[model samples]
Target: MTDQQTVTYGIDGMTCDHCVMSVDEAFRELPGVTDVRVDLVAGGRSTATVTSTGPLDHDAVDAAIDEAGYTLVAR
Candidate 1:
């Protein structure tokens, strides 16, 4: 089986493509992250799907999301 792991995070304050890029960039900076996708739910909660090689560091994930000027919530 592949070692790839995926996790989705609920986020707030992402209103457009620029926000998506910001979050994507922040997540990509994290260790082990292979890919990042953001589902824009403008004016409501959004989802960011993250692909990585192994278990993620939740704190780092949280920080990255925050760095993107968003809030991370339960998905």
Candidate 2:
């Protein structure tokens, strides 16, 4: 197996559990993703810690957030 990789993403518009669920589902659909944790704090912002089987693609992650109707903050 490949080494696990972690990618942090700034998520916008996640105001509730449903929003977190949406983001979680988005990451789960990725081919190499292992797990996703969504943490929402002040300013209506959230952080997603994505664990994957190998190095992840930043553009793909951003695209998934966009498809989920949420904004992706560049890191």
Candidate 3:
């Protein structure tokens, strides 16, 4: 077993549970990703905490968020 590493990303345009699920599912599909936790804030930036076996690829994470119809911004 490998130790999990977590990273938080700031996301915009997530205003509901559906949005949270979308983002969660997006990150869940990535290789090495073990878990996803979302802190949703309506009408503003939300935070996504991702746990994986190792450090994740920023570009991949960005693309996944984009595919989920959201934007991942640096915080």
Candidate 4:
């Protein structure tokens, strides 16, 4: 099988399903990213689990969250 990598990130400011979809789309646009799962937490920090074909660039991840109008936090 091909190599794969998964990463989880803490996201702030996601308040609903729309926010979730925005973040999901952001990460999905990145190369190698196969899937993105987000657990909404409203006003609290939420988590995003990303599955990819290989290691994802940390900067790209951060940028994706930012593009989605959320903050990326380490958990």
Global lDDT scores for all candidate models: 0.91, 0.87, 0.94, 0.91
Per-model root-mean-square deviation over C-alphas:
1.5, 1.3, 1.0, 1.0
The true-versus-predicted C-alpha distance at residue 12 of model 4, in Å, is: 0.4
Listed in order, each prediction's TM-score against the native is: 0.92, 0.89, 0.94, 0.93
Best by lDDT: 3
- Estimate, for each residue in 2-63, the C-alpha lDDT of model 3 and write its tens digit: 87898999999999999999999999999999889999999999999999999888999999
Residue 39 in model 1: shift from native, Å?
0.6
- Leading candidate by TM-score: 3
Per-residue lDDT for 1-75 in model 2, tens only?
A: 689988888888888788888899999998899989899764666899999999877788889989998999965
Kindly report which residue pairs in candidate 1 clash with one another. Answer: none
Candidate 4 local lDDT, 36-70, one digit each (tens): 99999998999999999998888988987898799
Q: Where is model 4 more than 4 Å wrong at Cα?
A: none
The lDDT, on a scale of 0 to 1, for candidate 4 is 0.91
The stretch of ten residues in a row with the least summed lDDT in candidate 4 is 1-10
Better of 1 and 2 by TM-score: 1
Error of 4 at 56 (Å): 0.5
Candidate 1 global TM-score: 0.92
For model 2, give the 10-residue run with minimal summed lDDT. Answer: 37-46
**Alpha carbon deviation, residue 6, candidate 3 (Å):** 0.7
Candidates 1 and 2, the one with greater lDDT: 1
Q: After superposition, how far is residue 69 of candidate 3 from its true place, in Å?
A: 0.3
